[model samples]
Target: MNQNKLQSLMLCLLFYSNVSVYPVTPETIHIIISEDKTMLSEWEIPEELTLDTLESKIGTHDRTNETEDSIKYIWDHLGIVAKFSKNSKFLNKLTVFYATTLKNEEPKQNFKGKMNFFSSDPNQKVEATYKGWICRFKLGNRSLYGICKGENRNLEQIDILSK
Candidate 1:
């Protein structure tokens, strides 16, 4: 993605909403890091998202796949794939695809959301304008990382997964 556009996206992510982590009726979607920088969340998808609560928040999935150790719920229109351990109900991974169309075409109407990452502690600051920095934080009781992958200069996906 273009540098200017990436910066713009980060800005929107950080300041689009100021509500607490679990917003009841969100006006704008967002993922926010805790004030201390050790925790991160996209509460719309929440740390506790599971098989039981999935449909209520995201509606029905378009597809589902289960393997020996995991299950995946895919929403094609929303470009999200939520994963869970076979024996667990909570999300083990969440994938958000961004480059949904062909090259030179307009960006698809993706998850119109924002993200905010900040730290008040001088020793723990993270850059929101990172070129390829790993965004690391805690997701519930697990350590997690959010990574952005690209192809042909287009942002392809953001994967938030256990570390």
Candidate 2:
């Protein structure tokens, strides 16, 4: 091919590749587990905001009326799942699994993260923040939280909530 024609074809191919590689945004849900491993809670946010906005909202109290009993019930159910083979040792190794779905109909992508529970008293409060689609979880104590971030099917970061 002539130089000009070859360059034109390369540019067109590059443009198509770039556009086809657009990242997919999915609804993100943050799961929080109690220190005692007796409770599990979750909150979901739409996938339109930026990560900064989600971070700013962290620790903002938005009560969900989730009682200890409900959390316990869910924990029991989760324990029976074969994938959670270490459920018996949950207290020492608190875990939070992040999940996402496209349009509420597609199969979910599960991303696991570690969490440290400080207290499990029913009076203790829980909070979360959403930056874009990234979500963070915080328990009653200021020191405990988990960060969940990813694009559609992958989890890039899952760090403990510090400082």
Candidate 3:
């Protein structure tokens, strides 16, 4: 009886302490970029891929949506969203998001100097490791509104534009 009561007390204390008992595992995607920061690629993926050929490299997307002008191919578990032109079918840009709290996403950054189109500079921070959070170095050609968008945030997503 005493042991049962002790265990129950311990469980109640832990639950009331506001401690997270379960940690979320993040989804990840890996990309290889060109030296000029204009092209994007991967292990088996080509430098430039169209909507029709994207699946041949990275496999089929989890879900997709389209507009008259553009199409989006999303891989939820892999944390990738490739956007392309509807007429040309050529890839316009791809986004990588990792923060799962807001949308249950995970990210893995494994770029070296001159490898990936870093945040305009190779010394910039790109991904949040399992140890802690990280910020995207530079913002792409997107609307910043008043402040720098995607700056100093936990790498929610990024647009890798094509040439």
Give me the candidate number with maximum TM-score: 1
- lDDT by residue (50-158, candidate 3, tens digit) is 7666655445666677778877777664556777787765787666553333332222331121224446556644433221332333334322111122435433444
lDDT assessment of candidate 3:
0.48
Model 1 ranges off by over 4 Å: 1-28, 35-46, 100-110, 118-125, 128-155, 161-163
- Model 2 over residues 1-163: C-alpha lDDT tens digits? 5999999999999986654432111222234445333222233332232323332323221121223332111111111111111223121222223443322221133443233344557677667666665655556544333345555423333433211
- Quote the lDDT for 84 in model 3: 77
Model 1, 1-163: lDDT tens per residue?
6999999988887764422222323225455654423222343445566765755554566667777898777765455677788887788867655555522222234645555554455565443322464444443333435444443234455564431
Root-mean-square deviation of each candidate, in angstroms? 14.2, 17.4, 14.1
Name model 2 segments beyond 4 Å from true: 1-32, 35-118, 142-163
Give the clash count for model 3: 3
* Residue 30 lDDT, candidate 2, scale 0-100: 33
Question: Model 1 scores what on Cα lDDT?
Answer: 0.53
Best by lDDT: 1
In TM-score terms, candidate 2 sits at: 0.23
- Lowest lDDT sum, 10 consecutive residues, model 1, at 18-27
